[model samples]
Target: MTLATKITLVRLALIPLYAWLATRYGSSVSAGQPDEPFRLAAMAVFLTAGLSDALDGWIARRFNQHSALGRVLDPLADKFLMLTALIVLCVSPWSAQHKVPFWFAGLVVLRDVLSSLAAWAIWHRHGRVRISPHWTGKVATVLQLLALGWVMLQLHFPPSWIVMPAAGLFTFASGMCYIAEGWRQFHHGPPPP
Candidate 1:
């Protein structure tokens, strides 16, 4: 395995850690335990994991170590972490009672699921599918990270009506962007190899 792969794996490994922290503090905060430490800790884990996501990609490309495995694992890890955070934020004791709409989470996961299926279909047809990460997708990801971070923090801080909608809007917009890209790929066909 390449060093990039190893780093990617490490990032994936951190998902459980992030989940545990979020769940632990989320429950406490939801229960009205008046504890800030767990919430803070969960936030820290989230930021750390997000940083690792960026680092692994940089390392992989900077060292010319990109691989098929890295391509697959990197996106998979991102989806998992993002989804896990959202689910924890929505379901934790605090969020369970005052949760972001379940449809927001549904939108996020459904988009990815549909995109994955499209990509697979293209690949299965022996089409040359170059998985060049799009700039819009990256921007969408940053928005997602920020929105989720804000939502998690709101669990302990002043709850904002804007955060949830902002998250849903950006997530939905991102999904639309991916859907358009997929359509382009389908109609125009993958660029000549």
Candidate 2:
């Protein structure tokens, strides 16, 4: 495996770690326990994981180490971490106030799920459809990472009001774009090789 893919796998490995820290700390905070230390640890882990995502992508491109596995695993890790964080923050003692709002999280998850289904259907029909990542999807991802970080700050509430909804909108729009593009691909066949 390429170093790039290895880095991406490390991110997948961190998902369980992120979940454990978020849940352990989140439950404590919800129970009204003093857990700033734990909260800070969660934040550190989140930021590190988030930053590492960018780093790995850059490494893959810079060194021409791209692989099919990297393409699949990188997005999987990202979506898993995002969905996990949103659900954990929204439901748990981690939130200072209700956050990652239900609609926001739902819309985000729905977009991802629907997009995945569309891709799978297209692939099942055509085989080896390389649906390039959409630009809007990247925008949605950045906004989500920002929102996740903002929520983790735990010193803020109002910004989430702005960020999560916008992220949801972008996510939804991107999903539509993917669906349309995938449909076009299936109907028209993959673009000129």
Q: Could you tell me which 10 consecutive residues in candidate 2 have the lowest summed lDDT?
A: 92-101
Model 1, residue 191: distance off in Å is 1.7
Q: Could you say which candidate leads in lDDT?
A: 2
How well is each residue in 1-193 modelled by candidate 2, as lDDT tens digits?
A: 9998888888888777877887888888777785787778878777777878888999999999999899889888888888989888777646556356778778888888887787788778888576688899989988887777777776465566687778887888898898889889888777865
Each candidate structure's count of clashing pairs: 1, 0
Clashes of 2: 0
TM-score of each: 0.82, 0.89
Model 1 over residues 62-124: C-alpha lDDT tens digits? 999899899889888888989888777667744543454677777777878888888877676
